[model samples]
Target: MYTTKIGLAPAIHDSFIASEPLGHLLQSSKWQEIKDNWNSEIIGFFDDDQLVASVSILIRPLPLGFTMLYLPRGIAMDYENTALLDYIFEALKKYGKSQKAIFIKFDPAIQNLPENEKVIQKLKNLGAKWMGLTAEMHDTIQPRFNAVVYKADFDEEKFNKKTRQALRKARNSHTIVKFGRDELLDDFSEMIQKTEHRKGISLRNRDYFEKLVDTYQADANITMVYLDLKALLIEAQTMFDQAQKAFETKETTNEKKIKQLENACSKAKKDLSVLTDLVQANGDIVAVSSALTVNFGTHTEHLYAGTDTDYQKYYTAYLAWFESIQYMFDRGAETVNMGGLENSLLETDGLLKFKKNFNPKIEEYVGEFDIPVSRLLYPIVNKLYMMRKTRI
Candidate 1:
């Protein structure tokens, strides 16, 4: 027999969730503090004194003394365990009634594969209203599709030619990747603002970034990519001098070799001049890109990232992403989630195109579900919510 316990200890709850296959950081007790505006609780299911299931629920107060319970990423439990699922859902429904909740909302991290159809049907059998499989970005509370890189070890060779070339160019241009906590937040925020202006979409602000860094503590990091113009200028000047000398010496008697030398000298001279002017206009070093990552269990999430459009040719974003992934892998992560992607999988989508270079596996998640507590109020609230989301 299973018994439900509310207000489970944080460490105990986290340990149990981390052991589950569907464990996620959003379901962590710490995440509750991040979403402090919502009244939250950690509920655990114990079978013979052994914790077998857990969910961190956020309570949103509604009009007329009603409430809505949301389980972000859903409960961490074995979906194959029908008995446990039935018990947990029954307990949740009772709990919702006690709180005067209109409904309970959840979107599990499980993939929408053929094998998982039975699990979806099981959820519906338990009275969950399955929000249809959606592909658009705004149709659900969380994205239905995600780009994830799953590997036991990091390998640059696995990346496609374009990605490898971009990494090489960033390295050749003297790009420096640095990792830190709040110290790098300013540069990260600046790059994010630039990205927002370029893409015309507002992402998280500085305060939210700061909160993430602070809340996650050692589990989170900000990786910044910088270009040392002074170093590049010196290197370019040296290359130009060498090319000019090689051309003048006429060391290669072949006409083809002579032409190659001439072109090399001309290109080197142009690069040297450009670097010199850039060094004069800007400082010795400038930030070009940055990424924010959070580590939980064996998974690392590349949550937010930004790059300066002016340095697009330098490919600093690629370097930042690569180094961040390396950092997470070294820290014992088996998977690095590259965050959400549009489900349409359009070839013209720049985000999808960029992530595809890394050869990520696209995860199509089972969409949201709503378990009605108040039959009449559930329909009204859900309809209003959908209308509001459509407008946004």
Candidate 2:
């Protein structure tokens, strides 16, 4: 028998933690720290002898003692199993009722493969209400995807003249691409701040970005493009990590320790080799973007991409994107998601227009779905929050 329960404490789901499908972006220590510090409840589903899946729902208080649950890139489980899904949701419903939560929310990490339309339908059939337009991306923990998913096989013939031209231009441009851990984060922070300010949006504080970099540095890819003489222009990141497997440092003094040390040395040597390659470049960075790749057995998401506007004329940002697409293809990725579209459908959205140029077949994602516990109070609280946002 499988058991489901609710509690503030972290679940003892070591097995799921060892092999659950999610990226480091969702599993970063900083994100976890933030969740833990905030009011949260762990919804764990367990098999007789093992904890199979779990979702951590972080709650925020609302007026009149109401609360809302945010399932941040959550619902860790076997989505193909309807029985498990129902079991999990039932547990959540019971728990929400007990907590007197206003509503429950989740945005599952389903990919665009097998078509996103089907996934949306499934969610509705499973008793989850769709909160946003099916065609428009929603405001949720994860960005709603309008991605380009490619097959595993490579097709050189599919490369159009424009794509080739972009690649050629990037190679011919006197620029260097650099990759590192936290070495360039402080430098990148300046670039991020500049871009955010231009977009009339506030960015994560310097400390938050630093903590993010530090937490995911082990597996994150920090990519930057520099022009002649290493002038920063584009700083795109292809951050990724295996969330299913985490290294558990063991206390040992024998062959195990020796092997662990050897592995660390080998990794350092390999990383240095790559760094050496980056240092040899001599171009100033003009535009850069970063993405987190989350793998879920049969799907993956190229999550989040931001660029610099200071050098938009030079089109360094295009070059960076071209390089990233090629990199994803080369890495045997089944689909290279260009990511979601925000305010792009508007006629004046230039960034959205640029992404559409990649010839991506745009589709909507299953956005935030809420299971309301207190139907009466949930709407009132939600309206107040929306009103506040609108005023801002």
Question: Quick one: best lDDT, which candidate?
Answer: 1
lDDT of 1 by residue, 27-136 (tens): 98888988999999999999989899999999999988889999999877899999999999999999999889999999999899999999999999999999989869
* Pairs of residues at least 3 apart in sequence or in different chains that clash in candidate 1: none
Evaluated against the true structure, the overall lDDT of model 2 is 0.57
Please identify model 2 stretches exceeding 4 Å from their true place: 5-30, 34-37, 50-52, 78-82, 110-128, 132-141, 148-157, 229-310, 324-336, 343-349, 356-361, 385-392
Specify the poorest-scoring 10-residue window by lDDT in model 2. 236-245
- For model 1 the TM-score comes to 0.92
Per model, how many backbone clashes are there?
0, 25
Worst 10 residues of 1 by lDDT: 150-159
- C-alpha RMSD values across all candidates: 2.4, 17.7
lDDT of 2 by residue, 185-245 (tens): 6555665676677788876655765555565444344556655424211121111111111
